[model samples]
Target: MLLLLSVCLIAQPATCRDEQIPVGGGAANAFVCLRNSQSVLAQWQDEHPEWHVEKWRCAANAAPPKKP
Candidate 1:
C-alpha cells in the first residue's frame, strides 16, 4: 500500500482549473470547482489507509521542488 501511494502523485495545475458546473443542464443543482480539492483528498485517504495522504494534499511521489 505504501509503495502504491508513493508512486501515485496528484496535484492541481500551476494555474488551477475552474469551471461552472450545472446540474441537469442548469436546472436542478449547482456545482463549483473553486475548492474541489477536498473531494480528491478524501478519495486518496480512503484509497490508501497505509499512507497518510490526508496529511499532505499531494501523493507520496511529491518531492519538494528542486532549487534553481
Candidate 2:
C-alpha cells in the first residue's frame, strides 16, 4: 500500500498538446503541457519571439505529449 501510494504521488499528471497558432502560410508549433504548472507555455513564448503561441486548456481525456 505504501509503495502504491508513493508511485501515485510521483506519477506525472495527464496533459494535452498546446499548439501555437499558425500564421499565413506558416506551420503550427506544438508545446508540452507541464501539468499546466510553472507557466511553461508563457515562458516558451517569451523565449521564442518568432512563434505565435496561443492559450490552451487541457480536457478531461487529454493525453500527454509524446517524448522525442
Candidate 3:
C-alpha cells in the first residue's frame, strides 16, 4: 500500500497530502492543511488512532510571477 501526504511545504498558502496507514494494513491518502502543518497533522493523528501517517508533502498553490 502507498500513502501520500501533500502538505504545504513552502511558507505560502498551499495544499498538503497525507497518507494514513490502517492497523490491518494498506494506506490511504488525505489532503489537509491549516496555518500550521504540525498542528494539523497532530490533530489528524489524534482523531484517527487506527491509522498512522506514512508519508506527506506539500503541493504548492502559488502561481509563477508574471514577467514585467
Candidate 4:
C-alpha cells in the first residue's frame, strides 16, 4: 500500500489556484486608465499665490487608495 499512500500524500489539496504576484504587502496591483481632461496646457507666465500649488483629482467616487 506504500504506492497508494505516496499518491495520497502527493495529491494533497491545494488552498488556492490563483497565480500569486507579490505586490505592496499582499495588496493587489491596480492602475487607473483614464484620460486627463483639462482646459489647456501651457507655460505659466508669472508666479502667483497658487502657482506653486499642485492639485490631483480622483473622480468623486474613486476607489479606496491601494496599499503603498
Candidate 5:
C-alpha cells in the first residue's frame, strides 16, 4: 500500500514556467516540466548569462491560467 501510494504521488502531472530576460531587453516566458525545471533552467542560465530568470511558477496541473 505504501509503495502504491508513493507511485501515485510521483505520477502527478506538473508544469513550470519562468520569465527570463531576453536579448531584446524584455522578459519572455519559458515553460518546462516541473520534474526537470531546475536543471533545465540552470543549464540555460549558465549558457546565456544575459537571460537570467526574473520569476518562476509551478503548478500541479496543465490547466491554463485563469483570466484576471
Candidate 6:
C-alpha cells in the first residue's frame, strides 16, 4: 500500500504555464512553464547579460500564483 501511494503521488503531473520571456530587446520572444521558470530564468540571465525582462505573465489557465 505504501509503495502504491508513493507511485501515485509521484505520477501526478505538476501544473504549469506558458510564460513569455522577452529577449533581444523585445524584438523576440521566449516561453517557459512553471516547473522550469526558475532554472530557465537563471540560465537566460547568465547567457544573455544584455537581455532584460520586460514582463512575465502566466498563459491562460496556467497555474495560479501561490499565496503568501
Model 3 per-residue lDDT tens digits across residues 1-68: 21224333333434344453221121122233323456556776777555555455433334232211
Candidate 6 lDDT tens digits, 1-68: 00000001113334222324422222222233444445556775576454443334333333343311
Per-prediction CA RMSD (Å): 13.8, 15.2, 13.1, 24.7, 15.0, 15.4
In TM-score terms, candidate 5 sits at: 0.35
* Residue 46, model 3: Cα distance from true site in angstroms: 0.4
As for candidate 1, its clashing pairs are none
Clashes of 5: 0
Please give the RMSD of candidate 1 to the true structure: 13.8
lDDT of 4 by residue, 1-68 (tens): 00000001113333212111122222222332112112111112122222321322222223433221
Over 4 Å off, model 4? 1-33, 38-50, 61-68
CA lDDT, every prediction?
Answer: 0.30, 0.30, 0.40, 0.21, 0.34, 0.34
Against the true structure, whose lDDT is highest? 3
List the lowest-lDDT window of 10 residues for candidate 5: 1-10
Q: Evaluated with TM-score, which candidate comes out highest?
A: 3
lDDT tens digits, residue span 1-68, model 1: 01111222344223222221121222221122214445554565677544443122221223342211
Q: Which is the better candidate, 2 or 3, if ranked by lDDT?
A: 3
What is the TM-score of each predicted model, taking all chains together?
A: 0.31, 0.28, 0.39, 0.16, 0.35, 0.34
Candidate 2 structure lDDT: 0.30
Tens-digit lDDT track of model 5 for 18-62: 332222112122333444456545765677554435444443333
Q: By descending TM-score, how would the candidates be arranged?
A: 3, 5, 6, 1, 2, 4
Our model 2 lands, by Cα RMSD against the true structure, at: 15.2
Worst 10 residues of 3 by lDDT: 21-30
Q: Is candidate 1 or candidate 5 better by TM-score?
A: 5
